[model samples]
Target chain A: MVMSCRDRVLAAINQETLDRPPVAVFTTCDTIGMMKASGASWPEAHSDPQKMATLGCAQADYFGLESVRAGFCLTEEAEALGCPIDMGTSHSSPMLKGHRNKYDPMKKIYDEPNDLPDIDVFLNTKRVKTTIEAMKIMKKTHGEKYCVVGGNTGPFTLCGHLLNTENLVYSVWTDPKEAQKWVAAIAPYCKAFGQALLDAGADIVQMSEPSASTDILAPSDFPIQSGQFVKHALGDLTGHTILHICGDSAPIIPFMFDTGVTGISVEEKVPPEKAVKIANKRGALVGNVGCAMPLYKGTPQEVAKAARASRDAGFNVISAGCGVPIGTPDDNIRALVKAITG
Target chain B: MNDKKLLKELADSVVACDPNRARIASEEALKEGIDPVEAINKGLVIGMGVIGNDYAEHKIYLPQVLVAAHSMYEGLNVLLPAIPKGDLSDAKTAITAVVQGDVHDIGKNIVKTMLTAGGYIVNDLGKDVTPSSIANTAKETSVNVVCLSTLMTPTMDSMQEAVKLINDNGYHKNCIITIGGPPTSEKFAKEIGADHRDDDAQSCVKYVNSKMKKEVK
Candidate 1:
């Protein structure tokens, strides 16, 4: 019997045995093709729940992928927390304009995280609420057939959004205790927002903490600076969760698993075989495809080759190494799905 | 302390990520009659170069790199004004910018710091810079290198546009254009008509230096 898309994904997350892992994008995958197919583009769909749901599900509807995700960018929490944002055109994802609070490393001054809005107020903020509502709509419309994934900024990254990331990182070296205080203060909001997504019908909360990636934080510092806080913000969630850290996460794969997440997503910087070996069945493994290369710029043949390699490498879910670029070619995505499902 | 000790102190302060120590060391180097340019090149620059290499090798990460960059800047603030005004006129010039539609500039900032440490007169156009502005800056300044960066794939088009503008305006012949950031690759660089691409700031600067040396030959 053929397993349902929803069942396949849940099974993959559970690390259950399957003939073929489902082809899904746990990260943001809203493409131009998706926009055209759904008639819901960015900068507008990013705000409208119905449009967001339409665009989010366009992946499964148009490309034959098995999971749906929403909130194309990581700035939702940052924007809701008071950072000015430039909601870019259909071609560009949302970009953070500036930090909401003072965090000048050179001047050695910073605003305490204590003044952040209450957790309830934060959850109900405009874009944050929009994402939750979109999750609900996606669940109602397509959740039975496909998993509805809710993407959110991780706590360390959210803290960086409020305070300047460079400044926060500088503190990690000169004054680590101060940096921990701010990240700890900001984590509850991450947890609350994640729980809200789950409550609103998202099957998985994929938290992207790019700021805490091995590229920025030393591996030794991950546990204290980001991993522990992430354990609370993501691990403590009532539903399944996946933690994504950009760059070569080979160094911190174990640390990421220690967060108690149901799965972890990594970028192509880590070799696919190396990632699986390092993961060692810690949990569900979801990626290794080069989003920039074969997916957006290379041919469909290259995309298929990559997809098969990920499957052969023993990844639980075949997905993008990172958020699928908005301009990724439709043929490449279709090739990825067909490579695995066929 | 002796002049040699003071210079070593300046480098040590930066590597140690202590801005105040770097500042004091810079002042001491000046008091000991060490040339400010030598203090920068032999001291602060050496320290930053070590940090940059460590970052490239993953021996250290961004936090240490940022702090070390901050410390170097603190020392530079002390030593720069003391240098004779025209001493830097022959220094190679470079332009760095985060392309339009992307505001994540941590990578760009690191490149800028590395270029500055490498003795380039880096004109940072800051974040969310338009492609036109980048091209115009390269043309107007006659820079020896143009470094473009954006962390988002959506903004890769902006980087491509900036490179095209530089090429269309005939500035590519005069300057080497390099692109960095997670989304960019050597393939993307070649596709966009850029001269080079690198994953880390140290390699970017090293590439520019090697190319400039070949040009001088």
Candidate 2:
């Protein structure tokens, strides 16, 4: 029997044998091409459930990616938690304008994380609600044919968003216990949001923890600073989970896997063979394609080359190393799909 | 403590990420009538240089670098005010910013700290800075270097635009342009007309220093 795209992705997540692994982007991949193809653009698609579902499915509908995912950016949780945001234009993703609380390490001052919104209240906030609703829409609209993937910010990244990230990172050295308190407090909200996404029909919850990557945190500190909290927030969820951390993640791949995620999505900075070697098939692997280079900047041939490289290196799901650049050309994305599916 | 011991304490304090120790050492240096500029250059900068090199070599990471930066600043808070205002007039100047449409500034902040430690008078434009603002600041300050950074690929265009605006305003003649961030590459830097691209702050500052020396010749 021919496997459906949805089944193919689920199989990949299960580490099941397949003729070929699925081509999907678990990270945010809503681009201008996708926006135009689905007739749903950002700032609007980011909030409207139907538009979000439409745009989220555009990867499968127009580009042949095996899975459909949303919401397009990482700011939703931060915004719901009270950070001021700039709802960017069609060509740009949302940006955090400012942290919600004072976290000044230089002055040794920080606002306590005691007053976060209740879990149910946070899950029901404007954009967070919209994302959960969009997941429902995606399942209803494309569930039979494509896997519905839900993307959320990781706990450490969310806490950093609530307080200033630089200040939080500074506290990691000056007062680690205090830093852990804020991340610990923020983890439940992350868990609640992930569970809400799964409850709403997402097949997989992909959590991005860029701030906890080796670039920011010492590899030795990863398990303590972010990994254990991520385990409770993501690994404990009732569905598949993929943890993505930006930068050269070779040093922390084991720690990421220690979160007990079904898989880990990594950026292109880690060479594909090296990533595969390090992962040692601990679980499903979702990425190693350079998002900026061959996908966003290079030609279709280069895109195909990179995609094929990831495939040949035995990635379970060939996908962008990070969030797809919003302006990535249509042909390049098509090339990625074609290189794999062919 | 004597001046030599005090200066070593200041340097060691920054390396150890001890802001209070740095502050105390800075106070002691001042009490001993040590030239504040000598204290900053030989003490704080030396410590920061060690941290920067460690970061570049991947021996240390951002948290340590950030704490080290804070320690350096704590010492600077005490020593900087004591230096005669005109004493730093000949220091090379630089401007740093995270280009428009992006707000991730940790990398930019590291570059700023390294430049400041390298003894450059740096004017930080902060995050979400417009290309025009960067160009205008470069022109107004007559800086020796312009450093642009962004962590997102979509904003790479903004880095390119900022480079063009700086050149269009003829500040390119006065300043060397450098770009950093995870998404930026040396190829992108060359395509965008930037003078240099580096993955770490220490090398970036070294490149700027090298270019400035050549210009002086």
Which candidate tops lDDT? 2
Model 2, A262-341: lDDT tens digits are 99999999999999999998989989789889898999999999999998999999999999999999999999999989
Candidate 1, A1-342: lDDT as tens digits: 778999999999999999899999999999999999999998899999999999999999999999999877889999888999888888888888888998876776877777888989989998999999999999999999999999998988999988988889888987899889999998998999999999999999999999998878999999999999999999988999999999989999999999999999999899889999999999999997889888988899999999899999999999999999888999999999999999
Which ranges of candidate 2 are over 4 A from the true structure?
A: none
Please give, for residues B1-217, the per-residue lDDT of candidate 1 as tens digits.
9878888888898889888999999988998899999999999999998889888988888888988998999999999999888898889999999999888899999999999999998999998899999999999988999999998877899999999999999878888999999999998999999989999999999999999987622
| Runs off by more than 4 Å, candidate 1 | none
* All candidates: CA RMSD (Å): 1.2, 1.1
Task: Quantify all predictions' global Cα lDDT against the true fold.
Answer: 0.92, 0.92
TM-score of chain B of each: 0.98, 0.98
DockQ for every model, please.
Answer: 0.87, 0.88
Clashing pairs in 1: none
Q: How well is candidate 1 docked (DockQ)?
A: 0.87
Please tell me how candidate 1 rates in CAPRI terms: high
| Candidate 2 backbone collisions, by pair | none
